[model samples]
Target: MTQRRTPSGQGPARRPGRTSRPTQRVRVRDTSSTRVEPRVARQARPVAAKRTAAQKGATKRTVAPRPRAITGRATVVIAVLVALVLAYTYPLRVYLAQESQIAKMKQAQDIQRRLIAEKADEVALWSDEEYVVAQARERFYYVRPGETPLIVLNDPAGAARDAGHAPAAPAADRWYDTLWSSVQAADSEPRN
Candidate 1:
């Protein structure tokens, strides 16, 4: 241990090989020159001064507590989000509707394509000589090379039900009579 003398003629002991720790400097505020704002002075002022000081300080905005302003901002954000969702949804709804319509049209087109394919098959069948002759003989009772043809009769009950529309006859009747009757019906004027 070594003894160190201060400038004021006082002695303090210093330890050997251990440097002294630096002293922390603290700044003291000089409130003498500072202005006491009306807001800060309001709390410490007398009741008589409180009214006057509060009136004066009311115009200066203090640090605001956050919730009200935060809630207001949240409301605006929610409204904007809702508006944006609606704006996007309108187009999305229309897009979905159009997509559904396109799907329906495509389905209808597929059905029509199938019908066209069936009609094409019929045309191919009609182009064949055997198929044409067979259809003609079945539908119109056509005979080939002096072949004897037989006619099958429809039920008498069905023939009676259709009697009012045209003269109902058995399918066993002569083909020439049925053909002549159909020609006469076609040449007649349209009924009211």
Candidate 2:
């Protein structure tokens, strides 16, 4: 017997030199009032046509979705967030500025404290009699009572004059007369 083959060639294979047999027909009794319709024959389609038909069906079923519009609730939430940010901006800036000012004030206070400590140390040093004597002796050439004072001159001319070898001023001309004469001489000179 020859085997029936499907259009897709997935049916059982046919044997060579076999004769085709007629299929048996079964008759069924009508049990319902519904009428039966005859089946329509299907034609084989090309692969490209089948693919295009499948693609058309897929496109019809799966349409591209449109972008959603913003809802009222979402808009209100975004507006609230923006308002919150705006409200916080000034306060945040002020807080940072005040913090920087506070830091600067603290630095100034630290510097003042250091200066006060230095002054206190200087006062403590001044309270010592030995340090005071040493400073006075070094700065003003002061000496203790009953101590002989000896002054050393740096200029050789001043040293020679102090030794009493220079000529003395005349008794007739007082010190003021000499000073006046020098001033008059300076006034008489021509200016550059």
C-alpha TM-scores of all predictions: 0.44, 0.44
Q: Give a tens-digit lDDT track for model 2, residues 55-105.
A: 532322233456569888999999999999999999999999999999999
TM-score of predicted model 2?
0.44
Pairs in steric clash, model 2 = none
Model 2 regions lying over 4 Å from their true place: 1-65, 69-71, 150-192
Per-candidate Cα lDDT values, in order, are: 0.77, 0.80
Per-model root-mean-square deviation over C-alphas: 23.0, 24.7
TM-score of 1: 0.44
Report the error of model 2 at residue 172, Å: 48
lDDT of candidate model 2 versus the reference:
0.80
lDDT of 1 by residue, 1-192 (tens): 435655445434554565766577977788799975664443543753766476643333335345565577799999999999989998999999999999999999999999999999999989999998999998888998879988879776767677755554646858898899999998896977
Error of 1 at 49 (Å): 28
Worst 10 residues of 2 by lDDT: 56-65
